[model samples]
Target: MTQQPAADPFPPPSAPPAQQFAVPPPSPSGRWQPERVDPLPGTEFGLVQLRVMPITSGLAIGSLIAGIGSILVSFLVLCFGITGADSGWGGWVSGAFTLLSVVFGAGAVVLGLVARRQIRRSGHTGQVRFTGGGMAISGLVCGCAGAGIALLSLALALVLQVSS
Candidate 1:
């Protein structure tokens, strides 16, 4: 009889071999050709957008800082003068600071209003409006507070003078 070769247990599938893919020839510059990439749906790509800072931003910040500085100086002078720690110089220093505070406060208020007007005219693009508007409003509030404190101090000084 015979030991016939064992019948192949599992036959291979009869699928066709995969075809080879074709690649484009390299360019004269020896670089691979650039391929176009599709952006994700509902997204934008390409040129970068630039925005201009609002004109009033500088003015507002300047006024706010000046107002705050004036307030601090005036407060220190008032305190030192009252406690007799500053002698006569305190009065002069306080007067100077009070004047500065009032000037800065008025500047801040004016700049804030101008900034608002500019924003309205510019038609709201990017973050310019937000930043400029916020700075302007904050400056206005800070300046008003500083001016009020200075004015109060001035009144108090006048009263003290009258009483003395």
Candidate 2:
């Protein structure tokens, strides 16, 4: 007896197939042209253009960093002074940090000024426009604050030494 193949439980549909999407051929320049897609019914679409933003000044960034470092070192000096740890090696360490704070503060001030100037002059010579004027200002402020604190701490230390 011949074994007949089991009858299929689900038969293929005899309905017409759905439409298929085709990709457009690449252009002569080897770049694929963007395909425009139709929006759904009752939907509105707008063309999108790429926009370029101005770059930030490196000097501004450096200034901000230096200013923050100066502030931190100044705080360290304050902490050491408050903790009465300015004896022997601690004193030397504190002094070093104070000096560092001053240096960093000065550097931050200089860099911030330079960065602001550069930002102002950006795009004048066909160069990319620079942003970060606010950063430069903040850096300058922080640098001044840090330097002031360091100087005040030094003055207080001196006064205490003189009194003793």
Each prediction's whole-model lDDT (CA): 0.59, 0.73
RMSD of each: 16.0, 13.0
lDDT of 1 by residue, 1-164 (tens): 88889888898646432221122335586533423233333333322233434455565566567656656655754664454322434455566667877887787777777766665666354444434677767767877887888777766654554454
Report the C-alpha displacement of residue 50, candidate 2, in angstroms: 11
lDDT of 2 by residue, 83-160 (tens): 444343445545777899999999999999999999988764334689999999989998989988977776565545
TM-score of each: 0.52, 0.62
lDDT for predicted candidate 1 compared with the true structure: 0.59
Counting clashing residue pairs in each candidate, in order, gives: 0, 0
Stretches of model 1 off by over 4 angstroms after superposition: 1-56, 84-92, 124-130
> Largest lDDT belongs to which candidate?
2
Ten consecutive residues with minimal summed lDDT in candidate 2? 16-25
